[model samples]
Target chain A: MSIRIDQLPRDKFIMPGTAACPGCPLLIGLRQVMMALNGKMSLVIPAGCSSVIPGMSPATSYGVPTIHVPFASSPAVASGLVSAVRMRGNNGPVVVWAGDGASSDIGFAALSGAAARNEDLIYILADNEAYMNTGIQASGTTPWMAWTTTSPNGKTEERKEMALIMLMHKIPYVATASIAYPLDFIAKVRKASQIRGFKFIHLYAPCPPGLKFDDSYTVKIAQLAVETGIWVLWEYNQGKLTISPPSAMYKDKSKRKPLSEYMKLQGRFSKVGEDAMKIYEAKIDAYWNTILKLSELYK
Target chain B: MQETIQRQARKVLVGDHAVAEAVKLARTQVISAYPITPQTLIVERLAEMVDNKEINAKFIRVESEFAALASVYGASAGGARAFTATSSHGLFYMYEMLWWAAASRLPLVMAVVTRSLGPPWNIHDEHTDIMAIRDSGWIIGMAQNVQEALDMTLAAYKITEDSRVLLPVAVGLDGFILSHTAEVLEVPSQEVVDGWLPPRDPHIPYVIEPGGEPITMGNMVKSDAHHMLLKKMMDEAMDGAKNVIHDVFASYAKLTGRNNGDLIECVNCQNSDYVAVATGAWSGDIMKAVSDLREEGYNVGFLRIRFLRPFPEEAIMDVASRARGIIVFDRDYSTGLGGIIAAEMMGLVPQSVSFKGVIAGLAGVDVTPSEVKAAIKDFIDDAERNGPIRIRKTWLMQKMEGGKP
Candidate 1:
């Protein structure tokens, strides 16, 4: 299923003057998701950059109803909201908009539980690689050798494979998208919305302040992530897998751009040595191999 | 207004079952919970009701107590009457969401089957679990038996949903003792409960609804004064609950012909030299002890403290002022500080009235009626000899190693 740019809704659900930093990809990605949802959804946002983007009391940038839950209970809260809506005889979608720290670390138990139960809700994880809202602490999703406030000397481990983790839950839908590709992101959301059971969409969002990059490079960095094969764009519907466009071009390792093209654009990996990058490359290769194995299951 | 009294049927039920019956009668729309000992029966019963279509509600079997309460918070904010149940460590896991439910001013109900917190892993009747959250801006109440557990669960919705007191309420019942003990409970008819407590008015400004104006809930307050003001509003809501609790109790009595006497239930305090204060199922033993002492020509009375959060200061003072001394029986102890209830009562009761804090029933150790009678007799004998008991606190089951009594 593909979304046509001309068919996209013109109305903006995200109002101006949010707390988002200049050129933050999360803001851009959020706008697309909200637009696709078109004010017909209720959001459960956990503590993260997106949580603060809604602004303070008596002022919210969201044009739809939003409940800000704790850092680890977004999925659980969404579960309750879904049940409540069903009890009211309404089947409108309930969405959990959370960050990497929430989805990968503190909130993993609840998220896994909701997925295992096949809850009828859509969970969108905007992965900025670190805990950006709390001063860029190293999170479970932070890439190998990435610098964060807590991991200032570069982290010692590779990023967690959360999208693959969600796939293992064997839910109805699981997808990965990037902020640079709005059409693809919106298309996946529209697809997931049509499903009945648990659906997860992993979004690669860029943070300017936390990543130590110029605000204008948000889109460039997000795009380079996919071009370099560091962030893959794909969807898992039922058991079938399809890599989205642009990212699908990198199906062959020889066709992908050098990893340095993505790493050099952000200061987070400035101190990273060649050995770490090689290890990261190996990890990415292993990840893609697993995805290939999963893709072959439905054939 | 002329009230029409409708006949309701009574059913034999345990404390856990009674709570489930009350939650059903209140027409809770959403129930989310994780099973813990003692409290598991309540959730199981609720799940059966939801599954059998006897209760038109959503039962969410969440992963943890944190998720359970968070789900309930979400459901409540979505303009639905929500509920959950937990005990001991489960309540501790829900500590964070308890504040969220209260500060968000969502009127949800949670039944706490009181159990001992463990390192030694014991599941028995203890008040420490509920007492831990006494200041979490929630209206707290405890039941003396299965009947009160049922009645209080019904009244909790009315008190919590009242506009003046839009806070969460936890109805506590002692683990095993009351939770598993069977008794006859008057299950109020649906028509009578509906007439007494109407469906929750979904007028909360922040509730998310279709076509409703978009709003951000549980937002950050930058200013210290603003944060303090929100807490102050919670405190004021708790203070305002005194009247709301009484009004609900009166209305429930008019409907069900049962009254818990609003906050505290006192017996034979009119002409007593000393009064025994207790809560939970053990309050029955204290009342029997009071009767035993009365038969022995001792001026003893019993006061069952139902609500612990709004502290029932006035009723406590009224009872304490008339007595020469007050003996507090606490089933839970606050480490380093002694009994929590005794600590709270020390400030409220007149200093002129001698007070003694007896810590007993830790980890479900039974505080038998004879034991209670002996304790009160000792207090009375001491007061008669020394003008008032000199000891501030006593460990009821403590035995001296050297055979010193």
Candidate 2:
């Protein structure tokens, strides 16, 4: 049983006493990450729910020092703070926790510049499909058929390929992780912690409130997301690529779950008709095929 | 208490080197600035001092004005005493981080040689460049001549780093006027400057250093709450800096045998009915002009505004209240708004008193001793005969185009 995260002798975090909604995947994922990291890190958050989630005073949920920087200047502020700490001879890892809105929209310039300079920091983007903090506004990472606040009908555009964008920077480490697989997520965070240069981790955090999904369905929805090829898991490290084979490597057709299995659970995609669903499926197929070709090149 | 009789080495140095020597005496820990005209020589001398080991300091040659200020911000946050120099466009380029340094409450000191803002790109002196950042929450001070330039540089560290006044400071020198001109200055000994100004306080910076695994200094607060803190802190510091400035000036006065009492003044005014308010290198020529007018037996006095920011509003108000009329000799113009200093003084004085502006020496143009003399004479004559409104036609703008000749 591949060492269940709950069963491992991981150090307990003094953070997050308040319960996340029952089976809230993101909170669970964060708990696992914090346990793996074990209090040797600092977190930089922009204007996101994560910035607000840390509890008050002695009841603090974040076990480590967490700074909330401005939305657009997170990368710049992080770089400045990281340099300052390095000057003082501290060797601890500096981590930035950003939402897709911060990473892909407002903070893009600062992020690109920091990565280009190969700053020693880890940037984690918890992409919950849309901007959940502000009532599910369509963000750059929102899928084609998702119905968000801005995208009142169905989203007309494709989701921006953020992990691929990060890969182009030729960073030392870049990976995608999901709540469906806790061990895989923890493994990727641990891998990032070992790397020296700019490391990026894109975690698919499904929001029950924004996705209009049932609380118990978070992990199942995340699993179906990868199985349906809507969220592919991969890592790029110094010109090498590793794509995790689909949930069931043998019986490829059986591994390919219907798109409706993922979308039907969320009200965000309820407005999408059959034709729109077909369009969404085609875009996901195109994206996976490109990823497969790149993976082959690296192999 | 003991009677101390200490003499300093009197030297004939350009304004740039005087500033460099003062900064050296202050023993800054880090000097990060890009080279800009008039101001470049100051940093150049600082670099030489670093190389010669006359001062044990780290000198970082950054890529741009933006980076220069940002680098100092990093250094200052780490508890190192940092300094930088820039002029004109370079000063303008660091505009964004100027507010950052002040808001972050770093006691970083920068020397800005005031040069004219460009269209033709003349590299002569004017006050507009530094004046443009007046509201950036910095403790702004101007030097009237080389002596003040040297004295004020040391004073800057003492004022900015005071626990009560933890804000960035800008010490301004007139471009080519004070920047390039050589003058007699009693540069203080390194030991004396060290005694006057201590190292930066350790507890101020909120940003955490790396090994300590500290968090950066920030978090989301209510907008009104955050702004109120900025306002409350800034107001307290600025108000505190006024007294700190005076005490340091008193100490500096004792060391140099020059009384820099938050201001400099000359009064033919015991019998004189009119006064001129001016500052920087031009104030020297204005003094000569005041003497020439005094010879004509017109009751005239000269009040050189040594410090610009903290405006010395009370002193000017006191002087203007006694004078029959006032003439403001401004080195820079504010386009459609006329002279900035003239406007400021006008706001301070009673409506009963009259004043006119003699906008001169713009873009480093020569405001000769004779021209200042003539303008003062005309201002007095017009003010005494006519009302304050029509004191004199604004003179000296006639020769404002070219750089120093």
Q: Which candidate has the top score in DockQ?
A: 1
Question: Looking at candidate 1, what is the lDDT of residue B328?
Answer: 92
TM-score of each: 0.96, 0.76
Candidate 1: residue B386 lDDT (0-100): 78
Cα lDDT of model 1 by residue, A1-299, tens digit: 66788888888888898888898888898888887877788888898888788777667788888888888988888888777767776777788989999999999999998999899989999999899988999999998889999988998887788998998898999999999999989988988888999999999998998888999999999999898888889889887898878788887999888998888878998987788779878877887777777778754
User: Compared with the true structure, what per-residue lDDT tens digits does model 1 show for residues B1-405?
Assistant: 123333777689999999999999999999999999999889999999999999999888888999999999888877788999999999999998888778889888999999998889998888999999998988999999999999999999999888899989999999999899899877778988888888987665357643355777866655668889999998999989999999999988877778868889879875687999999899988899899989989988988889998989998888888889889999888889888888888777676777889999898987789999999998888877776554557889957599966
Off by over 4 Å in 1: B1-6, B388-391, B398-405
Interface root mean square deviation per prediction = 1.7, 4.5
lDDT, candidates in the order shown: 0.87, 0.75
Q: Is the docking of candidate 1 incorrect, acceptable, medium or high quality?
A: medium
lDDT score, candidate 1, position A204 = 93
